[model samples]
Target: MKVALIDYGSGNLRSAAKAIQRAADENALTLDLKVTARVEDVVAADAIVLPGVGAFADCYRGLSSLDGMIAALNDQVITKAKPFLGICVGMQLMASVGREHGEHPGLGWIDGAVELLTPSDPALKIPHMGWNQLNLLQPQHPVLAGIAPGAHAYFVHSYHMVPRDRAVVLAEADYGGPVLAAIGRDNMVGTQFHPEKSQATGLRLLANFLRWRP
Candidate 1:
């Protein structure tokens, strides 16, 4: 299978690619992984993985700067129903709008908005870092197969996505309060946590994603 690891200059390209490659190797799955910025590569790929870090507006800007990338992504991932995985800010980009710097439009694949993490407790940090236990909302989801409800995943972010439709949320973590950990609909799934940095749990999820037919 051909997997396009999108490189729009905002994500941890090498680490994400390495983790995905490791997953494929461990599963004995033959995957043609391509770390690319080209729209043609994305169009030709069997699946797509979008990994991103930093601010929402900045990441969106970087991705939009790439000629025809947005359109191609829409066609391949949405129109054609290609399997897609978005990590961290890449997941936030799936929301309708982002309120990090200013109100910036997103891909709007999922009905939601990205907003700052305002934990109910005052002592909690803005950027929710480190490993947190995932509370699986949809444990039966294919990408989450073999991943237990309390499995720990690494996270580093100051904002969280609030999906208007609660059914899209697949998992959540508590950082003084409930914070979105995962979201999905149809062939698309996203994680606020960095699966590439989540060690064994991360690898398991990635391996599941690699074999996921949807």
Candidate 2:
């Protein structure tokens, strides 16, 4: 499968692609990878991957500069059930609004909001870095196959997405509390953490994503 990694100045495409390549190798699957900043890549890709880091406002501005990415994705890929995945701030960009820019609008593909990760726990630390266990809410889906309820993965972010619909949240993790860590709605998949940086567990996660067919 040809996996188009959207490289539009907001994400770590090299690291993400490296991890995905490892996952493909592990699963004996061949993934033709491309870091694309072009319009045709989104349309011709077998699946789309949106990976990002940094502020929501900056990311949004960078993405908007691409022209018609949001529209093509929302109107064609997502609405038409084409496979798509998002990582870290990439997931946040899919939300309707983010507080990063003091009410910055997002891609509005998913009904959700992104807010700074405030420490409800006095001792827990911000950013939520390092390895943490994922609390799987529903493991029945193929996208989560072989992934246990308490699988560990690396996380490095200070913001989390609060999906407006409970049905869209596939998994969560205990940070300040139980924050949304993963979301999936039909063909659209999102992760608030960097699966690419999570090592073996991360590889498995990406492999599962590659194997997902719904």
Candidate 3:
């Protein structure tokens, strides 16, 4: 299968690439994959991965500047229902608006908003990093299947997702609160955690997504 990792000049590109390679190797399957900023690659790709690591507003601005990138992405992902994956800031961009930048509009592909996870408990650290357990809300999804409930995944962001549709959440993790850890809407799926950094569990999730026929 061919997969395209979006290179929006976003951070974590190489790590995401290595992770995909690792996942494929673990499954003994070869994936035709490359990192390109080209819109045609995204349009023609069997699966599109939007790997991001940066501020939501800045990422949005950069992507918007790229000629026809957002339009092509919308055509392939939002309209055509091609399998799509977003990581970290990429996931944040899928929200309707993000408070991080004074209420900037997102792709609005999913009904949600991005906000800081405020904790009633004191001493709750922002950017909940390291390995944390995820409660798989939608276990039947190919992207989440075989991954046992309460598996640990890597995360490093101050903001958390609040999807308008609870059904869109595939998994949730506790950092200081129960935040939407992952989302799957129609042919689109996104992860706040770095599957690349989560080791075996993360690889399983990525591989499961790749093998998914729908």
The lDDT of model 3 is 0.87
> How many clashes show up per model?
0, 0, 0
Give the better candidate number (1 or 3) by TM-score.
1
Q: Estimate each model's TM-score.
A: 0.99, 0.95, 0.97
Candidate 3 residues 96-127, lDDT tens each? Answer: 99888588999999888999878666697776
lDDT (10s digit) by residue, model 2, range 58-84: 988888888887777776566677788
Model 2 CA deviation exceeding 4 Å by range: none
Return the lDDT, model 1, position 101: 79
lDDT (0 to 1) per candidate: 0.95, 0.85, 0.87
Per-residue alpha-carbon lDDT of candidate 1 for residues 48-130, written as tens digits (9 for 90 to 100): 99999999999999999999999999999999999999999999999999999789999999988999999999998878999
Model 2: which residue pairs collide?
none
* Model 1 stretches with alpha carbons more than 4 Å out: none
Q: Which scores greater on lDDT, model 1 or model 2?
A: 1
